[model samples]
Target: MKSAAVPRSAPAFTPRALACALSYCFIVAPAASQNQPHQGAELPAVVITGARFPAPAAESPIGATVISAEQIRRAGVLDVNSAIRKIGGVYGRQSLDGSPDFGLDLRGFGANSGQNLVILVDGVRMNENELSGAILASIPVDTVERIEITRGGSSVLYGEGATGGVINVITKRGAGAGAGAGQASGYHGSLSLERGRFDQHDARARVAYGQGPLSFDLAAAHQGTDNYRANNAFRQKSISGGFQWAAEGTRLGMRLDSARQDMRLPGSLTEQQFIDNPRQSLTPNDHGSTDIDRVTAFAEHRIGSLELAAELAHREREVRAAYGLLFESAYRSRQTQFSPRLRHSARVDGLHNEFVAGVDLVRWQRDTSFGSSASQDSKALYLRDELRFAQLSNARLAVGARHERFEKDEANAMLGVPAGAQSQNGWSLEGSIDVAPSLTLHAKAGRSYRIPNADENGYRSSGALLDVQTSRDLELGVRAGSDARSVTARVFRHRLHNEIFFDPTLSGGWGANTNLDPTRRQGVELEGQLSLGQAWRLSGQWQHVEAQFTAGPNAGREMVLVPKNVVSTRLAWTPAAPHSAELGAQWVGSQRYGNDFTNTCGARIPSYATVDARYAYRVGAWEAAVSGLNLGDRQYYSNAFGCRSGIYPSDGRQLKLSLRYQF
Candidate 1:
């Protein structure tokens, strides 16, 4: 699938975005909140714009948080997941390996935690359509410069899965405002190395240069672990390259991101395996590997009052895994996707409005050797509008719509699934109002529908065809604070119709999407950051979630793995020059649910908490940090699946230390 080129005019960056970004200084003026500390002890200040451009997070018209590079270093984050997990209203949970297998459950929404949320790398979508899931592992943290998280329904600005929220991973860019001519065109780069228990070894480096009218950046990194347990080893390598060009009224760029991982996971264990020996399996039943390649290009031009941008991308992924005794059965899959989009912007009066409409055409061809068999194609179109309310304290509202058509190809005879086609359509709307200089309120409600995959809808009928899956959601949020103290909270609810669950006893691999049941999720979240003075800072977030089968055949049953509560907190101290200390903790509620419908275990996953501490020291052009995770030596299962009968044990307490030098 491809997009037809259209001759269009360029759109210029509006002064409003710049104005809002600058407003942070005034809005957070010390005199306004004189009681707040300014020097002795405080949290480091951070900034972010939930929109395309940059803005101070507190002034952003949405529930958002900005995690700074300094904070990332203090927490010893190896991945974006680890950083965001420390934020409130955000929950990242996955199997032991920390692969894309993790799910992101936010604010009572995103129960399945897959594609329910949106992941953007410098404004590009990273969700996979095959399983409608996000590939978190595809992005490497070493390449990231900052992360902007907008929690709650955001389908208005973004297309789908904005149901829960949006995470924008902004990469490093050219010099900031203070740099001089020589520094502006000069070079910048860093190199780092790390070693730890479990045979872990890693090295990374990045370099960049900004010259007149042109700027470029390139980065590469590699990591490997003999792993903490038998049959649980992994290795990975990644490279990223990007460039930007600026002219009188044009800004153009392209980026290429690629990665590959070779891993071995001990297959899921039955209850007996957990009790016998958490890591004793040696039948070679646990092993898998994944390969990923992606390339994306984008261009933007600004002409007078108009702003325009275009994007195109191609990606490929392949996975091979072994399971069962002696690796008897296995699942192998390969998938490819391509997308192209165009956006336009403009301004009007005390009201600045921007329009963006585009087509996302995808041809996903997949080959699976075991379990589900299939191949398919999907095409979609979407349109969105963002309107700024200059008269209402920088308020803004946005609305968007999307439509898709799907067709399945290929069938597995033994599986009894036939080829079929399905079409799906959806629309979303959201609005935000900044009521005061220090506070913003936002709300959104939208509907999303997904046609079942070939394996779900067209499975042959020695069985029957299943129905499509549908969902509706509503969200409200408020964000208030200043440079010294900030707080953000959101409440949300979602109702899923035609819920699907695999039922092994019934027929062809279990339940179908056609099940006329309703699954409902509701929750609340709170996150806050405090800068006590210049030396002490504290951050904390809490979430409450309740998911149940409402008004359905499975009424009253709590959704599997949908934890009822999660909380995390962090503290950092930088009282003296060249020194910083940090502490962090995470708590996960109990979870009980199995892939197989029959093996339901209402057992609560014993909620567990892990603590970590870090210390950093700087000398000249070099900086060093040492850290420890799971300091209490906590032992527990990472994930539970298959009706409480199956579980995957995560690694126990591990130690990691690193050092870095910059130029």
Candidate 2:
């Protein structure tokens, strides 16, 4: 499927959108107060991810954020990245190729962020063994029940690729057998349609049924768009389904998901080219397509005070791309994973304790058209214990450790023996205490590691395998406030060694994977939210980071593509029943470019701010919303290549109108 190119002179807001907005306003204005509903109520506590078992975020020692399904619907965002970007201490940018995939940065890892951060769906690892990172587009927003983010290292609980943090996306599931079977007798479903600027169109449907010991859910979605820039268009289709069965003491579940996407890549623009016309496509002929299929099955059983669970999952993906008459390539990857966990709780000497142990095994293979084929096998085991001291002001302590091994094999012997086997171990310790009724203090320290991936270890330019990247981190945090409002502040520092990075100075400027000297990343994060009455609410976050090499040629230089300061704020109003509006602003500070690791290029990306707004109304089973992004029409770039040769521009002003019906 293809969409016609949107003209450059198209207006940001069309007449039809304006008319609809006016009509909605007229219909909802007078009836607002008549049906006024309660607002500013506190939400229920939810389970936090990156932990052995379900626990409230406020009680966990780790810094975390939970984005609820209601919030996702209110924001009217189509992509998971956009929904996550609204939170604090997170930086997300579109990929350079103009695909829906996003490059994420957490804890100031810069270009290595993709490998440092771990993303999961329903507790299944989504981070591939390759360099493409997570495919956030595969899981549609309609299927997400909630998303949980845990900042800082979590290798003890989640294993590898969690040096920076972890993001776990939890999907919706049916109720327990015999609990809601009578209430679920009827069909429940929802349909949504969205139309936006740049000729963008989206349609989605979700349906579910539950009876006795069986329940099922199915969803499908399609989206197409003629993007702002020339030769940058995208079309995507996805379908997903889930089934569950419950018995006396056991529950079984299975899920199947698939997605296909085709997108035209406009490439990047030079500094002069950007200043002249940001929408022009220098590489108009570049394009790419991707197909993905995944299936997962899980079972759980409870006996006395112990619970046991196991999962088996498989995923396959194929990618094809052509780069403007220069090169065409095809790649395929298949991965299979198995994990089993056991948890038990008990009380020892008046101290409540929970113990958890898990084992994970994963094997994956990749084949590329460039005669590069490789397979990887990884095995890991982890154990954690949490103890609560009710006699000591509700103090809590957690300690955990993990061990992992990696084996790599090359299809061709010419690839230099496929890099040697690698192994690493990590551990974490954290403690928290309640000083007062509304004040808590916590401290944490941990060591984490990440093994090199196929592209990083088996590069054709250099037939050498890099050592595992390792880091030690320490953090102190304070949280104070009541359930109605809260404030959180944290200070953290990380010392890194053997950091793996691609160096353009090696292998005749084609770039090679190399390990860097000692480095450090220290930062502070502040976040607060308040309710000023029943109708108004406000929240904001501020972060500052200093990331640099400590002992190297680029010593004392800031890391490339890492901003020093970032700020975001939002204000929301709920005047009456079924009506709400939110306005948000985000400011990003300037930073060095990708190829200027030494900070001697005299080139720096400038700072910029953008404003976004959304208004939503719901009555009965119908919802209507209008959202505007980059309302100020700001021009900014998230990433750039060296020498100012390739800069990727962000989208300009865009407005979307959506309608949803549920039954």
Report the lDDT tens digits of candidate 2 across residue range 1-663.
122221132235432343334333323334333243338543754555546555565554367777777777766778777778874336777576555677888888877798999898888899888878788887888878778888888888787778888888888775447222123544687899999999899999998777778878899999988877888898999999998887776788999999999999988888777777777898878999999999999888889889888889999999999998989999999999899998888987779888889998999999999888899999999999988898887888999999999998888777664646888898999988899987888888999888888888776344467778898989899877654466777899888898888766677777777888888889987776666566866667766789999997888988888887777777777776789888888777777787887788776877777889999898999989999988987777877867676688888788999999988
RMSD to the true structure for each prediction, in A, is 10.1, 7.1
CA lDDT of every candidate: 0.64, 0.79
| Count of steric clashes across candidates, in order | 27, 0
- List residue ranges in candidate 2 displaced over 4 A: 1-38, 56-61, 175-186, 247-249, 348-350, 460-463
Could you estimate the TM-score for every candidate?
Answer: 0.84, 0.91
What is the C-alpha local distance difference test score of candidate 1?
A: 0.64
TM-score for candidate 2: 0.91
For model 1, state the Cα shift of residue 273 in Å: 4.2
Candidate 1, residues 1-663, lDDT tens digits: the string is: 122121122123222332233234333545534365555342433445434543344435355676666566567777677777753336766555535345666654423465557787777677655454555555666666677887665654455456566888776655422222233566887899988888787788888778777887788888887654577777888888877777776767777878888777766665566656666555465666777777777776666655556666667777776665454343444444444444455666777776666665556555566555577676777777778887877777878777776777656666666566666567667788778877878887787654554544543223454555667878888877765677676788878776554443455555433454687878877666666555776667767778778874567766666667776777788776688888887676665554523225545455666788888888888878888877866655646666545666666667888899988
Q: Indicate the worst ten consecutive residues by lDDT in candidate 2.
A: 1-10
Give the Å shift of residue 170 in candidate 2.
0.4
